[model samples]
Target: MTAHQNGTIATEVSHFLLNCFVRSPSWQLWLSLPLSLLFLLAMGANATLLVTIWLEASLHQPMYYLLSLLSLLDMVLCLTVIPKVLAIFWFDLRAISFSACFLQMFIMNCFFAMESCTFMVMAYDRYVAICHPLRYPSIITDQFVTKAAIFILARNVLFTLPIPILSSRLHYCGRNVIENCICANMSVSRLSYDDITINRLYQFALSWTLLGSDLILIFASYTLILRAMLRLKAEGAVAKALSTCGSHFILILFFSTVLLVFIFTLLVKKKVSPDVPVLLNVLHHVIPAALNPIVYGVRTQEIKQGIQRWLKKGW
Candidate 1:
């Protein structure tokens, strides 16, 4: 394309206005309060977890390394989605430049997939720890965590990179309003003048391929874990084993369930208000981020003790 042609395309797709739930001007103030609180909680919780893991030498292990990675992903996810949402709600800063929108879309897609992969890896950590306790030191090593981190980063980034690139290449022709909070794939793609069949199909396949595989592996890991726990001779042993993984399982369940519901709501958009999926998307980012560290800190003995030791040393 010539400079003129590129300029024309840029003009056609200059900015996108994001939609919000509160159409009334008076309600934005009230809405801002809770949204701000959630953002703060998500950041504060994840930051504390990361800092604790960083300072404590005892936490320098494969499992805690994975937990730190989860905290990092959650922090990035919250940062990617929430501040802009709060800006929209509070200052009505809804007009996002075309380049910024695609960048946001890329980060959101990449991080979410990475987060799901982190959960899957954590489940594998638990599985090895429980199902093959004697060999866990050999199986779940620092090298293993390093490989898993690289895999999560590379796999998700490579697969999700095309989504925003494809979305950005479409001709807009002046209808640039995105009817959602974040730059969701379908929501942004539908604004284009071009047919988005391939975009839609790719998104569907990507969602299922990454998340579906993770969910299946997570389920299988937990199943083997439960079976192993059931075979323990002592009742206390069974209880302890369940307690170790219960928090992670709950967080994974909530994370995957909310996301799956959001995807279904996307399919049935005709029946539900757009606000439903928007709110779900917003909560989907913050809720698990805020809860993951808390659940693990309270339930996982090592993390609980680590937090206690860190607190004893002062903040």
Candidate 2:
């Protein structure tokens, strides 16, 4: 091809090659099996939890509704990223179209923020249930859940829509290789020939502002819940409170820890292996998803009994 044609193709790059762990072809075979299993586990677990919640009329409450929302978000996240990753690993099909890549980027960015917002709302639900029992019925009604769902969608969509828009506007000249499993905002933006200062700054500011605020609110809600729990005078009240909040706390801890680790790895990308952040990013999507429903099913007695009933009915 002539230099002119090369430049033209680069400028009008229609697709990108995802170099997902391409440095270790042998590892792809090993990674493919486990990733596939995790994907299946996440789908099945979340599906079961959703079905259990739907069928069990007794479980029709704000908390379970929020849990269903979380499951839905997890399933969307997994579906958005995992199938393409598995395809890349198993069949060596690394090419993703330009539009598809940006669409994936949008879903990843938007859904993650939506999940964080959902967690924050769930914390509020728990707060009302544990701290203000009398008002819990009034405050966390089906109407309230519906409003929260709307807020989650609106807030995340309004803020996150621009990430892909900003990223997609940048010009790509000859370099079309993305060095990660998914079209992470930065991973895609960095491949562009255009200056991405605005893109980076917007993403950084938005991420910290959106997710950071959610974390702060969640922490505050739990703090109040803990204070309320400590003031309990009834026998086994504290134990019961702990049991109630334990599952949520565990999921929040894991979610925050993994996200913080991924951010840290990105900050020190120059010092660490390039694949470290990539691996963390990939696991962050699947591990928590697979764990969320399992943790809830095991820790919450209502959910467990509901699952048993669901299974019995299935049989």
Candidate 3:
């Protein structure tokens, strides 16, 4: 494309962005401040957790290693989604080009799907630690993690790739403005002139196949873990089991609650208020990423000690 063609695209993008979410309630002005604060806190806390984990040798255990991966994913997930969202809130610039929007969707889904995979792996980790203690190392080998990570990456790529590519091909002359604070899958879908039958069907299948299967496995693992704990005769053994598994429990709760809201709202709610989706988006991304680090850093003794030692050394 010529510079002139590029300029035209830029102008259209600017216009689309300016008008995007313009119909949102003025209450966004009030909400954005608090959300920004939370986002900042989440970023800072998650970063500290990741740094402490990386710096400390004692946290090289399997569970902490997984937690560190989660912390990294958490931070990256927020970094991928939140700044653009904040930009939309602060500047009202939402005119993401078709290509640009698809890129965002692709990256977001990739990290998020990786996160889902991590959660399932985490549940299995807890199960092995608690129920099948002797087999933990052999079951969750280095080869297993490498294979699992590759599998997760491949699934995410396959799942979200079509949504954006299919979406980019659809022409949008009507409803130029995006209703949500950020360019979401559904929001972009809403603006399309083409029938979304295939897209919706894929969405359903991917959710049920990947997410549903993961959730089922999670429940199965947890059941075994709980049963083993109940059978434990010693308090110290229970404490150790809980110590290793406890962080995962918090993680499960955090993910199930936050992501469910977004998933349900996306699937069921039509004509959702612009601000509501934005708020959900913020919570789904920022809060979890930020909270994960803080929860682990504060609750995990080794991480706490590591942070203190670093500080002491600095001082």
Candidate 4:
């Protein structure tokens, strides 16, 4: 029998069931293999990137510092969502405690926003490096990175803290099934019988405002960068500029594209299989985590050289 509550507040409900593709039990068994592999790859790649940046003196630049921070965020974000998901797939451990669910939701919201902010800052870093080469050192100092770090953390935390807190206060009223692998804001908020329009509207407004602003700024930075490149007569200058910015651009492109796809899937949820959104949601967390390091390792000369040196030393 399912749990029931008489009052408006559903405080009696201790946990919520994460209905991660319950209709297709057998398919989960097969899906678990790839998910597990992806998780491992995401972990290994991001860890390698972090350690490489830390150990290599040559990579001690503002650009690499931001990349290292990106790797850290990617790793934490992947860890936050994927382990519980894999547990659900492998062990049928679908019940998440109320507090744990809220925590997961908080981390996902904050870190994802932080990642977007980091990308915008990184775009600025590239812009300064390419467009104003002589002023790069003075412009992107260690103090600037510290300020940017504070901004990313403070902006995201302050904006997103309300989401989980608001969800926690609502009356669940005994409907505890979240039909997704991860604890999302709407997933939790929708369970409330009370008015959730405020929560939903705030979430929508905050998400677009933060991400949209970052996207606009990043696009403008890159545009100016391209314009600066165009003014240069030497082909070598253009190639050098592209080489430096290419990895960051590619990763941001993938990240933004997948997120857009996820949003589109949400808009057209009725037309597609329910599994599609779930799968996309899960992939959005892991795919970018796995790709960021690999793109940097291959496309980034400094990181590639650092990896080779680290391999030689066998650490």
Candidate 5:
């Protein structure tokens, strides 16, 4: 418990989602209560979103179908890591084995990749529906959506699985403890005594390619939608069009800020205090999970009515 061959860095990391300083006050501090609430809020909102779509036949259209898929992705994304995250915050700081950590990272990256791909598909779906409403059904069939989803899954798996391969090859001379909350790639890579040049290069390239492409496609679709809305020549059409896009735009902005903040924090020129970076990381994880569902629910009337109906039936 006292010495290490690597260096004199007095680091004792628990193998858990939340790498709280155990020597300090217990992890069940006041802040944790609100985080727990935020986690529950995310789960409930996503569950309500899925239930609303399924219960309403009027919402059985292709647009709602894609929304439900997005909700499902969000649900799975939260479920995969949030349980472990909460466990660390509430219970003991559970240690993540090397394999378990790799698996969690892989799955997290897969869902993130899948979510990005789904947005591109959704952008195209919106484009077809708005730009060519008459041919919406012909252009976006149930069979087509199924095939598209499959392709998205295949592409994400093919590209992202290599991350673990690269990760596994690296050896951890000391305990496999990650700083900050999650087993983030950056955090893990910092510990490696081996070369990480190629891994870092690939990560940079992939982030630029995937997230950049999604943002480009999303903007392109909105441009086309705006053109169509203008051509409609109806006064209310502009308002309605903005309403339709508001939720998706919010998601894009939220994610982009998280990415930028996390990346920029890493690039800070000054002496970036440790706690600041960790809090930024927490935002990247928590804010989206907490705010997204509220954004979607407040913006969509159909979801509100469905929730009301479900509540009435329950009572």
Candidate 6:
């Protein structure tokens, strides 16, 4: 029996029942195969990318380090959200404990912010390499990458830790059904009977302040990079620069574009199907991960060669 049907308010709900596509069971059947395939592909590809970078001594550079960090983030994200989702799809396991839900929420928010920070750092790396070629070595050293990684972790944690904490403190009187696959912040918070004004306000402020700033800085870095490439008078300078940045550019574009779409669909949820945002949210977690290594392998010659060498050695 549900809390509403029990006559008294159950203030302490033990778990949340994730109703992934509860309105349409058919959708779960349709999505199960594709999502499983994407999850496997993401895991395999990211693992390959990480191993190739680790074994290939030639890839010991700031740029490749950041790429490996991206792959790691992708793998973490896939692991955090996909396994539970697949469980729900295949075996109807949707009972996520209260603590586990909050944990998932924290990781999702923190890692996403970290990924954005990584992209911003990558853009700066590109800017330095293209706009100030001579200073790239000194500015983007191994120590510099280490410092940037530290900053990414500290900054994102400081900013995102409050989200789950705030949500968890809310009084969940009765409802424990989450309408999405993963424990999305707002989705989980909305289940509580208490006023979520502070939660919403803080999330909005953090999203704008953190992600907005990263986007602005990434745009500025790329703008400078484009201007630098334009002024190159050498016959192959522009092409070479494009080749160097093409993979990063494409990856970031997809990342930012999908994120913006998810945000948009969320904002206009009243006008769209409820499942649209949930589906986008799920895809947002997996698609970029699946694409990252593939895109790099196709566009970046060094990584391609590294993968080839690794395969030959394995065989």
Model 3 residue 152 CA deviation (Å) reads: 2.1
lDDT of each residue in 81-180, candidate 2, tens digit only:
9999899987889999988999999999999999999999999988988998899898899999999999999999999999999998887767889999
Cα lDDT tens digits for candidate 6, 1-315 = 333434664656778999999898999999999999999999999999999999999998899999999999999999999999999999999999988999999999999999999999999999999999999999999999999999999999999999999999987767789999999999999998778999999999999999999999999998999999999999999999998888999999889889999999988999999999999999999999999899998888889999999999999
Q: Which has the greatest TM-score?
A: 6
For residues 1-315, write the lDDT of model 3, one tens digit per residue.
Answer: 111332353222322342334565465577678778877887788777777777888766667777777877888777777777667778766667666667877777677777888899889888987888799889877677777677777877877788678766655643467766555676677775568877778767876787788899998998888889889998688788888778778977888898788767766668675456566776787777777877777788888999998778779
lDDT against the true structure, each candidate = 0.87, 0.91, 0.73, 0.91, 0.73, 0.93
The clash numbers for all candidates, in the given order, read 0, 0, 3, 0, 2, 0
Q: Which 10 successive residues of model 3 have the least lDDT summed?
A: 9-18
Model 6 lDDT at residue 122: 96
Query: Candidate 5, after superposition: displacement of residue 267 in Å?
Result: 2.2
The order of the candidates by lDDT, greatest first, is 6, 2, 4, 1, 3, 5
Q: Give the Cα-based TM-score of candidate 6 against the true structure.
A: 0.97
Candidate with more favorable, higher lDDT: 2 or 6: 6
The 10-residue segment of model 5 with minimum total lDDT is 9-18
lDDT for 58 in candidate 3 is 75
Clashes of 5: 2
Q: In candidate 4, which residue pairs get closer than 3 Å at backbone N, Cα or C atoms, i.e. clash? A: none
Q: Give all TM-scores, in the order shown.
A: 0.93, 0.96, 0.87, 0.95, 0.86, 0.97
Candidate ordering by TM-score (highest first): 6, 2, 4, 1, 3, 5
Which of the two candidates, 1 or 3, achieves a greater lDDT against the reference? 1
User: Candidate 1: lDDT of 159?
Assistant: 99
* Candidate 6 Cα deviation (angstroms), residue 186: 0.9
